[model samples]
Target: MTVPEKRLHEDGDGDGDGSGANDTTALEEKRQNTQPYIKGIAGIKPEFLAPISSLSSTYTEYNDDEAEGGDRDKNGSQNGNGDKRRKKERGQNQKRDLKQKRDTVRLCVSLIDPEDESTPCVAGDEEKCKYSHNLEEYLASKPKDIDGMCPVFEALGYCPTGMKCRWLHSHFNKETKKLIKDLGKLETEKDKSFEVNLIDRESKIALQRKKYKYEISEQVIKYLDSKVQRNDSHQENRKENEATYVEQPFKIAEKKKIDLRGAKIVSPLTTVGNLPFRRLMKTLGADVTYSEMALSVPLIQGHQPEWALPKAHISEHPGFGVQIASSKHWAAAKAAEVIYRTTQHVSELNLNCGCPIDLLYKSGQGSALLDQTPRLLRIVKAMNGSSGDIPVTIKIRTGVKENKNTAAHLVDRVLNETQVAAITLHGRSRQQRYTKEADWDYIEEVGKVVKNWNEKREEDKEGRDTNPTWFVGNGDVYTYEDWYNGVAREGVDSVMVARGALIKPWLFEEVEAQQYLDKSSSERLSMLDKFAKFAIEHWGSDEYGVNSARRFMCEFLSFTHRYIPVGIMERLPPKLNERSPKFVGRNEMETLLSSSDYKDWIKITEMFLGKAGEDFQFVPKHKSNAYENTENR
Candidate 1:
């Protein structure tokens, strides 16, 4: 038996066209040397042959840079057939990847159905008639207003008629309404504040595809099918078949040390790092999560509430690192000591020096530390020295202002001055604030520099088993290929995901499985419910706690909607920039995000912060597209 030979074959028709490229084949043939090549030695898997052999040569059929008359004469254009076929091939690969990615892990929500009498907790705080009766009896038995001092639950506001903290209930309720009214006003005004493009029903899929294209960018080829569209009848059947998909989760719990000496994480990207939310991320495959950056004074003061900022569930034990900001070394040391001594569960203590907001900066801390490296160094050294057994970390930016690129130098200083566990460098300068493309090339350069420095140190001191400090790359790693390139580019130990992780908790799910998940709205909402439970469980379930949870959930809804596969109620993965069928509740959040009006996003934010949102503004540390939309901030 003779085995056929294989190569990338193509049809070279006249006029440099892709015509008659019906099906060029890649026949697997055997090779021979001094010894004859055995039959079946090439070993192309039979099952994958159909897809592999279907593609003609992948050589660019347009450019003539290589050969005269080899390039197209028509306005730098490619033969339409080849372009279309290439697009189709790309789409097929993406679909296959999505399947693999979504198959990694599935998150489960714990919302109790109000109608389930057999259960104790009812729809998260709401009670059935029997429970309501019991609650009334319990409250009646308690002495009303015993201490005259409102309880933390009540002072922050949770008591009253019907067990509702009327203030918080009203606050959460009104914030939602105000957000809608503001959005309505924006619609009437039209493109004044920002062009609100709600991801709508008709264009949800188109928008999702567009977002995928933008996110993947140069990482992977997107094969789109047009001329030979899927068989609608067969497509529906196939869709139904694909709907029963689940992700196999990989639980990584080994105690690996982290390094954050010269790193930079957006200070307090809270919603995702909090309980339930962080757990969701872990289930989705996140490697690290910083506790919402805590305030140093409160933390060291032994304020019981400040511990809340640094608290973590056992699930987040090894991966959870507490981040805190301080202007003084003593305060930083005190906070680090308290956290290390108090929470036997936390893995590392992170020093946050990357925040750019005015309040924190003006108060002599946060990104302001960028302006004072010596002070920052002192704080880092203090934590590194004082944090016993526990590792110490730091997050830093490229520099204080735009012109000064201090990060590479800072990494050098940190290496020289402190023994940190890991570093996360947000590629943007303090001034840039998530406005532009990250300087990944510079980050790679810094990683190489760190590696070289480590080598030199080892050479200088023999027999000293100096562990390699982990260097995590941050900024704009949105897809599997992006992650693949970022992690493998140089000595980058891992990647710290902030917004991308928040937008799609399952993003790490893709990186681990080497694919993407086409999550539905119901699925995304379920994750939100888990986050809410985690928040309530962590923050407490009193009126204040519940209202705060609802409020933040609304804030999260802004980013979350961006990840919800559109057409959730009826379809899946809504149009990228189109509005949803309507903006109503959580179901409508995706549409609001699709619109890209920061006001709508901010309006949703007001749901937690309360009515006079116009008076205060939140500038996201890593605001994507903020360069073009700086006016919004």
Candidate 2:
């Protein structure tokens, strides 16, 4: 199914009234265009396309100006001093909050002697404590009308926040006058092992102490450092004798082969590709999933945030990969070794060389590595050697700039110099961002190169030990048709989905079923409910947990709202670049779900999470530049 080149309204069908005959005509055209293009699926009924009131009261587009109006009024040009004071007060408040949190975590009651004055109270001194030591007082302070218990305490048997938890009334026993600590309950709960998969605190300490052995990785790092220290002319001579200097490839009698042919793979999205989302994607029929890109330096330095990236749901195993970005051989080698030592779950260790974020690019870690072919090769080779049994892979773009495509050369080099198991080539240059369509022709050409390389290698008896690298094409794959057509291209084994999956995570389900599924508004809400459940399970169901879930839900909605319902589209298989024209849905709930307004997203979250506090506010990750460019338009 193909998208129409022009929208109905854009084709000069408007009657200047902005309401009346022209509007009715456009709605009819939209209805006619809603016929299912796929062969098997039943076409949308006319009733499904019947227009509601043009002016939707249930939905309103969120205006950033309106949201920030109060702030503007208080901190406008006339209140420069007040703005500065407010900023200073905010900073002070943040510091105080951090200190208080630390104190709360550090507080511990002496289990041996609760009455000892010398022993610090985990609940602090009873006289000055913010929390009630008596269960009766805690119960009295809580609302008499409140419903339900603390989900975290109910699931884990113990609350990590202790007295500070907002649901303190839930776990405290009035009859026994004691707090129940049943932490072992988590052991039996299904899919609640996210924390168990992370690198342990002791392991991190060992890493920092330089006590954990990484013999092979250390050796590779030393060799690469020496190579870097050599004079430019000597380095050139070393390149001429590259075979002599290169480390001998490690070999086993047999290695596990990775086959991603026709696999539904999700790309490593930065902030949006958290564990809950990957788990959701797995349930939705995605064959492969990757963690968000982590920086190698932070991983080597034992940073908690970086280490968290590699944690995966047990269900994602046998197909989950942890992707890392690095500019240096040592960082890449060491990080891979750490991952190898820490977990048995990773299917592959992938190097990310296609990230285009300015900070990453400027740090010489991401797409900037494209300009330094020698360094890039060294990092990939080092990671391949250090990552034990897991296969090494790399993701790259066409190139860093427009008009010049360098991926073919890089792919050829990797195939010859390193034993990488796969290469994913995003068919657009870094500079292109999302401005233009991905260059599929160039991707097809690169696929041919890989195909020829594999054919030639197959004919050579000695090269059989070196794994046949799979070629995966990425970009603009949104539907079953796109997935099928992409893999059908010569040498392409599979496709990697990014924004497409974010916009419609059930995309893999569609690919598996080989048909368009026009999901009902209720069905879509059910998907959101699943995500919320996952989030609450992973992040806990405490006050902070609920807020974090809400924030991430909004982030997910930012993309989900872009899904123009197939039953309302002016054409079959809507293009990713096509923006929706304002139109109401058949029902108020559907219209609310369709709204792009951040306010509406928050409202939707409230349906599952209860009312948000007044302090709750959210801004999308990608700011709309439409307002800034309006003058030009």
Candidate 3:
């Protein structure tokens, strides 16, 4: 458990020769006396760890009102405190009225046609479509001139949201007295069929009919079950048959090796790692990207949301992986079967055994699999059997607890018993969270073990047909230096970035240049603009779509704001965990852009998407402790 104490710049760059010895001694003495302003928690000296209270309580608050105007009243009315309070009250009332008006404007609508045979209309069925059927009423309410058209209707031939869509007027042809349908824009019959399927009806029907079967998964699961049953029954004779069981070989289909050496991988982030974000990362230089962790049970049951996770943008090929979390072998196998059958974009199927979220762990999925090694093995084996040609990979942690490190043992078992193509180990245990630095020393130790195993396996087999499992290190890699140092030290093939990518997606760009990038405010704004365009393309440019884009934009801003511009930093290579003192940006726009307020994030989005409707409101996925001071605003 003892980590070797090494200086950050120990590799060499010091002038410590006999020449200018007196000058070097003086410089070293000065360096020892001078305290460097470390970013975030790295600034805390090891000696101060015990006396420091909660790290969360130490952050300095930045008051927007003070930043905006030094002496102006809250309302900018030049009035006394009473007048300012009254104006604030009036503003609150106005916001409430706007919210009420938006509530009255229904956004969801029925797309079902009562006359169509495929559209079921059941009387007294509470779940049946209750949307207004009177087209004339909707037509009369429409304005004389349409400002914008519905992009969904233009692309997909029909509007799925129907009359409730805010842009219905643009899609509806008044003279013809019917909704316009354009089939030419659709790329394939399958695409057209999916549009007609509407609300995942076809998927549901297929699931209910049992049309999809996990042929390979079932066979593997059955085989594993029989072995377990046989072992249990022959407990008394287990020692006699132990050698036979240990040497048992499992059948695996031939597949090409997956090589991800020096690849820039963006971890599959929940809520934030949508298709649009992955597409953006690909454009920025991400070599490998994974889908958000889709639950296997939902994918097997044909849930639309779960199925959507596996869908990759056309640009994200060659190294696109679909990650799934499952507690049971059947669910993992069935989900893999569906992906293999339905999609051709997947390069690998990754089992998520490192997620530390309580809900997932409590449900016997995610990091819980780390504790249940036998079940984890079965799930991977089943998934591999079902996923034809697509290699199975796994993402794991050091272990579940701080004291016990089981990842090396797990790696040994996987290498010996399974045909997994790769393994990614996040260097922290589930209990460690982000409080401590990643255990790179331990990761290096495990990497050595894997290397030895691979060498031995290669010596045994003259042919290189069998692919050695590639090892990847994850956790706390933020810059080119970190990536280089981790890979060089741990001997990992590559590293996966999660929050680092979120905070500064251009980390890959920095890695490509092998240096830090001090992006200007305008350049940063342009990046946001590009993301907004991508979001509009994926989510559509309609009112709901615009709002959805803005919400996610705000989410991105929440992370992006944490990026301290290199120009303003006191040091090189900012730490991910560092907090900054109150400071204004170089320009007003930059200052506004750097504001942690969600309202300011919306304003930034408005520069791209136009002004948000009065009805628009956004709550960040991860709540900010700073919001308590300005929540009323």
The model with the greatest TM-score is 2
lDDT of 2 at 393: 89
- The residue-by-residue lDDT of candidate 1 on 1-633, one tens digit each, is 111222232212112222323212113221112222211112222322223332332111211110111111123222222355653432211111101111011111111111224544433454433234343343343222212222222222322222332232332234332111133443454322111112233333433343312221111111111111257667865555445333212211222365533232222365445555665576665556667767887654544445566765556555677778889776676556545544576777778777655456667777788778777777776665456667777777777777578888888888886566676777777665554556778888788867777777778765145556677787765555556667765767666766666556677766667655666555665676566545554444443444455545544554554443422323221211211111223435444443334355555433332342222333321222112343543
Error of 1 at 148 (Å): 35
Off by over 4 Å in 2: 1-196, 209-212, 232-255, 622-633
Q: In angstroms, give how far residue 404 of model 2 lies from its true place.
A: 1.2
| Ordered list by lDDT, greatest first | 2, 3, 1
Candidate no. 3 TM-score: 0.73
What TM-score would candidate 1 get against the native?
0.52
lDDT of 3 at 72: 16
Q: Give the TM-score of candidate 2.
A: 0.76
Q: Which pairs clash inside model 3?
A: 40-578
Clash pairs detected, candidate 2: 108-122, 109-122, 157-182
Per-candidate alpha-carbon RMSD to the true structure: 25.1, 9.2, 12.0
Local accuracy of candidate 2 as per-residue lDDT tens digits, 432-513: 6554567788898999989999998999999765788899999878777778878878889899998889888899888878
lDDT of each residue in 1-633, candidate 3, tens digit only: 122333352222111122233433332333354635332322322322222222233332221111111121223331112355743432321211111122232322332322244544443343554544455564454333224555456546666555544466666666665566665655542242231112245655586577765556666655555455344668756455454555424466676467888889998777677777887898889999998788888887777766767877667877899888889887888788777766777889999998766556778887789899888988888887778788999999899998689999988898887778888898878765454567888898888877887788788865355888788998777777788877786458788898788878899999888778988899888888778766765665555666778877876787777676666654555566545433456777766766666677877887777766667866543224224434433
- Residue 64 displacement (Å), model 2: 19
In angstroms, the error of model 3 at 157 is 13
What is residue 68's positional error in candidate 2, in angstroms?
28
Candidate 1 regions with alpha-carbon error over 4 angstroms: 1-256, 259-268, 460-463, 564-633
